[model samples]
Target: MLVELLLAAIVLVLLALVLWLLTTTRRELGELRQATAPADAVTELLRRQIEAVRAEGRDGQEAVRREVSDLALRMRGDIGGLQQSVASELKGVSTEVTHQLHEGMKLIQNAQTTMGDRLDRAAQVVAEVQGSLGKLGEATLRVVEVGKDIQGLEQILKSPKVRGGLGETLLAELLSQMLPQEHYTLQHPFKSGERVDAALRIGDRLVAVDAKFPLENFRRMLDEGEEDKRRPVRRQFVRDVRTRIDEIAKKYILPDEGTFDFALMYVPAENVYYEIIIKDETDLADDPIATYALSKRVVPVSPNSFYAYLQVIILGLRGLKIEANAQNILNDLARLAGDLDKVREPLRTLGRHIGNAQSQFTEAERALDRFGAKLETIERKGGAQAELPEVGS
Candidate 1:
């Protein structure tokens, strides 16, 4: 726009100059014609100079117009190029912005997927914890019930008959849990008409277990406060344990009835068993209850000791079964090895027969090759008779 305005101003200035020159020329011609003759040399020379001035003025105006037109063309071309550059820059920026937006959307989608998976796993963990808590609550109730039952058992132990019955029941329960029915019996009768609490059959030997416990004197000894009274009760307790051991030995350890030389006196109570084994801890002489019982072939056992004995016996039985199975397997393997050795002889003979057959086949092939050569020789000689080998050779 500025270039066009400048061009218009230049054209106006050229037109104004031409109009001024024309006006001056007209006035000068009027003055020259009026003051001098028409053939005057001064008047003609002035008129020619005016005509040259007019022609130069017209040429200058034409050159100025041409320059303005060329400058306008150049400006228009620059403006068009500038517009194209700006449009291309704007398009590149739009494409970049679109690409960034797409990438951001993908990242957001991935984050959502990962978050959903974590939420599902967290919900599953919460559900599993709730189930475990329910099981734990049930287990807590069972423990409470077991505690009550233990308290009732303590009360039952106060009665002598109940205590003996409890021991028998415990003995029965252990036998049932640890041993097969065929290996043990409850209140087994003998030829002497004597009944024992329980008997374990180990091979041909019977191990009698007597569950009678003398607890009154032992409890009195433990309860007595006076040393004088306590000492007497302690002595009585030791005497009672010895008496029970003697009774068990006399009744249960029967060689003629296929029982062991020694019998087990199952005390069921650990405290009583401990008292029988421990030496005197007072001014009194050492208690010889354990020694005396051992001498009489009577072994006193507490619940823990009896359970250990049962475990040992069970392990021994399992060992015997495994040993027997191993022996049978070894015998079978020996027989199989002998049978394989017998089969080896026939296989060796068959191999020798195959080697002989292969040797005979090779010899036959060579003989056929020799016979073909002889026939070819006869053919070349036009069927002439040839000497043949003797049949014996």
Candidate 2:
């Protein structure tokens, strides 16, 4: 387009030069024609020169106009092409922006929905916690009443709810659901014999888990405010826990019964377990009273550690699945063998009885053979006797 404009400008300048020359040439020719006498030859030559200049100027002007028109047409085409290219580029950019806006709006909406769901969950959790708090108040009242009732019974020499009796049983039942039924065997004295709270059977060894932690003493620790007044009671409670672990090890874990390869003092209460683990004393070995062993090692496990133990049990159960499968195959083989023996015994006995009966029948078969020979002899005699009877007739 720029080239076309430049060419048009050049053509217009040439045409202006041609028009000026043509006018000057015509004026010169008129002057030359009017002049006469001996200067006529000079006037005639000037007239011919003016005529040639006029003809050449007219041809140049025509050519210049044609070139200007072509250049103008080419410039118009170039401008139209540039306008189309600009329009298409703008349209593409606008379309891309619109697409991005839609995507951004979708992401915003998704984020809003996710935030709303999380808020709803938080509200639900708050409601549930409020309900739980109310229930906990009622449970506290029941426990107080139960403790008073048991104490009243104990005064009368009946011993209502002892620590190792009903409490351990209830706690064991709660523990059983989280654990394998076979791996954890309930050992409350309902079956007689020196039983444990629960026995976790691991291979040939047993982890005798006794649920015996003085919750009452721990509760006193929680209840006590003054450190000076609380210290003596707190010290006694520590001693009580140490004693409890030792007593459980001696009572529940009988090495004679293969009870304690290592025993577990299963505290279902996390706080109680943490208290013992965190609670230090003069007799404590590693961390606190929990890790401190009595006979061999009584590993104290709270709810969390017990869960870890349960996970171990789950993996153990998976391994035991293979043992169970092998056991089932062995049981099936034994049953098959027993059934085959049952069938085979009857068949063997029947064969023996048949042999005995055959012995009894051998004499009878021989006697019958002798009787048949005597009968043949009688037949021959009868023929001989028939001729004598004919003579007598």
Candidate 3:
């Protein structure tokens, strides 16, 4: 646009210069005619100069036109190349954007797959936890039921008869576990018309056990708070235990019925056993319950101590049986030794008779061989072969 405007201004300036030159030449021609000397030559020279200026202006206008056209063509080519380069760059940018979008989609899909697997595993873990919680709930219910049963048993144990029964049951259970059936008897009756709780048979001897425990006063003594009150209850408790021991001694220790000189008094409750033993240890020897019981041949035993005693008795019985078997074995061996001595001479005589019979048989065989050789020689001399003595003869 600027080049076109510049060419138009140059053409306008050239036209204005030609018009000014024509005006100046016409005035000079008029002046020369007025003067009338060389007016025609000057006018001809002015005409030639005006024609040269017009041609030069024409050439300049053509050159300016050519320059304007070339500039327009170059600007168009530059604008086209710039448009193509921009289009190619835009295409590359679009391809890269498409590739990036595809990669982003793939990443999102992979993330979704990983999240799904993790959620499935978490659900499995939750199910397992729920199952374990169910099992734990059942175990808690069982524990509550067991607690109720224990409370009920405790209430039952407070009765005197129930306590006595429990003691006897415990004693019986210990006997069953520690002794063979033949070695023990339950509720064994003595000649004194008293039925003992249990008895152990050691060889031909019997050892009675009494399971009845006098626990009423002992319980009262334990429950009382005042020292003065507890002292009387304790003394009464000790007296009751002493009386029970005397009764057991009088009834169960029957030497005439094959019982041992002493009897056993089993106290099933460990606390009661310890109380009596502790009293005996701390009290005066003359008034000691243990000493008094021992004097009457009534021995006090706790569950653990009685078990130990039973083990010793079982061992003693096994030793006695082993001793008897060993004695019988020795007797049998002695009898076998005597019988072998009696048969020794007969075996020697039988061996000598067999040796003599073998020697006689050997001599008869040698005689038979010589007779055979003599018969063959006679047959060769042409003589009638004499009848050889029969081998049997």
Give lDDT tens digits, candidate 3, residues 76-193: 6876787799999999999999999999999999999989888999998899999899999999999999999988987888898998999999999988888889999999987657
Off by over 4 Å in 1: 1-159, 180-182, 279-287, 337-393
The C-alpha lDDT values of all candidates are: 0.85, 0.73, 0.84
lDDT of 3: 0.84
Give the poorly placed runs of model 2, Cα more than 4 Å off: 1-166, 188-193, 279-287, 323-393
On TM-score, the leading prediction is 3
> Per-prediction TM-score, please?
0.51, 0.40, 0.54
What is the TM-score of candidate 2?
0.40
Candidates by lDDT, descending order: 1, 3, 2
Candidate 2 — which pairs collide?
none
lDDT value for model 1 = 0.85
Residue-wise lDDT of candidate 1 within 285-314, one digit each (tens)? 644777778899888788899999999888
Flag clash pairs in model 3. Answer: none
For residues 210-276, write the lDDT of model 2, one tens digit per residue: 7756766666777789977677776777878778777776676666666655677777577776666
Minimal lDDT window, size 10, model 3: 278-287
